[model samples]
Target chain A: MTFSTDIHVDKVRALLQAMEAGDERCTVEILDDITQIRKSELHQQLSELTKNLHQTLDDLDVDTPVLLHAKHDLPDITERLQYVLNETQKASDKTLGSSENTLGLLEEVGTMLEGSDEVSKIQPLLDQASQELTNIMLAQSFQDLTGQVLNRVILIVTELEESLKALIERSRHDYDAIPQKTQSEAEQSAEHEKGVGPNVTAKSKLDAVESQADVDDLLSDLGI
Target chain B: MQINRDMNILVVDDFSTMRRIVKNLLKELGFSKFDEADDGATAWPMVQSGKYDFIVSDWNMPQMTGIDLLRHVRADEKLKDTPFLLITAEAKRSQILEAAQAGVDGYIVKPFTAATLNEKIQKIFERVAEKQNK
Candidate 1:
């Protein structure tokens, strides 16, 4: 069944108009209808692209598992994306207050340094303030480290999506593997819901235990 | 037991930072015969070519991840005997069991120290040595 973009466009326009009108309640039914329609169309487009890839590349002998891997990587990536989002929220909450305080310290140090009359009296105090600011910056802002790592991850994930398209173009093969990736991602989320936050980096409130023997076994397993 | 110094090693992970860290650690472990693959899909062909003796792989990679690669290696007759170790952030019970079931030589969770890496590699070799002797 073909979905006319025009209808979807009109509904979206209507939805935006409702929002612009300061309508507090955008009915759930209306939202669901728009989402379902949009998703179906998106999936259809995806299917078409897959078919195009198959017709173009799979006929050739080039191995496209890399491409297929990228395709299948989406679900896990989406999960990871959500995780990054959550972590970013947590990180922001933890650090943003301290970060602003550190910046305020910067202004204070600058203001004191610029004062000519009390230079000798304030010099040592200013020096201590500067040092404290640096310490706070280091403690509060992982901008240079985790920020860089997370940024790189985001870029690579985006590249994987683009590369999947290119690999399909290069191989002309539709990767049947994409769905498997999604299925695996679904399994992971389900498992995590059952009490294992496998990919979680932050210390959790959950009653999960890390055993010393398990760590020992892990060491042994590492072939050390 | 091929004591081939020429035997290549493939380090598989989507993260270049991780790949570098693992490769450096492996280098320190006296294994310079090495190569890098971004993920399992990329590493498989190298393994299939019978050119690699060792695989130090990250479990959570884009395609053909460490676990998947180890499984593939275990399932394939020619590659089955090759020593495969998993380096990952994933240290869940079922995941570890799954890797063990797939015949992984070792599993190293992330934020691992160099000492930890060395210990794991030594244990793997000792196990392999015992098996060969038997």
Candidate 2:
């Protein structure tokens, strides 16, 4: 359905003209053949475009997500990235504070140990060090929180990749043209026990598997 | 209600760092015994083993999600009574309701604090005590 230079309007008109003059059987056969050839042409053009775009992305050092951002006119990711940076900084500060407090307690204990004969005098400092260590442990929880946030960001980036890939593949007349199998096919080949990744954001989630025909039809309407 | 500090606990999350963090937090709260699995797939077998008295799991994982694991645990007669707490970043009301219907003992949204976890665990224990008293 995509309207491209490769469609060859003259060739299509010739086929239609032949169909009009021929017997019913010959007309049906010629129409089917023309349709198949058009499908193949669309696939070829799509594959070439995808290849060129991929190479351009590589040359520019821009990933598919960046390309998606450009195409979608997405908001800057700087704020999200900045949030991560801030959290990490706060966690590090908490960790350093706890560690330095523990260090001071240790030093006090060491001083008491050197000056006094009784071990009980250092007990209070040891207790304080233990509490500070616990604070350090609590501060360490930031790693997990930050990790989860980063993982969510990673999921977003991956979803962007999927959307971009899906868009490119959509230009093809057939879903089977991509070398990589569809998710369903991959699931079956893996015995259907393979787990899917986390759910993506609402927008990309819908884009994941829109029919190739629909995309081609839209492109055709746009005269692309 | 007095917490059973000796309870055998299973902490499930794909991230090892999260697992360790949760374990340390539990230790701070005076709970010592711990077991860990990276994902719900691995944790399912451990849950089935009937060794753990409590489960604290992250919702999003590679092999099986925490919701899937919770469903499995609830379906199994022996494991049904085990205190299962879900930790998730998902804040959708529908998901929260689904987890509740799936028989999760408690839900904790992520980037949670130690105080939040402790409070939820305490509440779960209180509910269990009330059920036992009834």
**Interface RMSD values for the candidates, listed in order?**
5.6, 14.8
Residues A56-121, candidate 1: write the lDDT tens digits. Answer: 665544344554456655545655665766676566656667766776876687686775887767
TM-score between model 2 and native: 0.53
TM-score of chain A of each: 0.34, 0.33
How does model 1 fare in lDDT?
0.68
Single out the weakest 10-residue window by summed lDDT for candidate 2 chain A. A173-182
lDDT for model 2, on a 0 to 1 scale?
Answer: 0.69
Q: Which regions of candidate 2 are displaced past 4 Å?
A: A1-69, A72-79, A104-115, A119-224
In the range A95-187, model 2's lDDT, one tens digit per residue, is: 778687777777776776874677677667677877767777676777677767876785686676567656555444222332321247555
| Shift of residue A73 alpha carbon in model 2, Å | 8.3
Please name the candidate that would achieve the greatest DockQ relative to the true structure: 2
What lDDT tens digits, residue by residue, belong to model 2 across residues B1-134?
A: 79899999999999998898899999999999999999999999998889998999988788888888999999998889888988765444445556666788777766678987898799789888888899
Interface RMSD of 1: 5.6
Error of 1 at A222 (Å): 14
Model 2: residue A91 alpha-carbon error in angstroms = 1.3
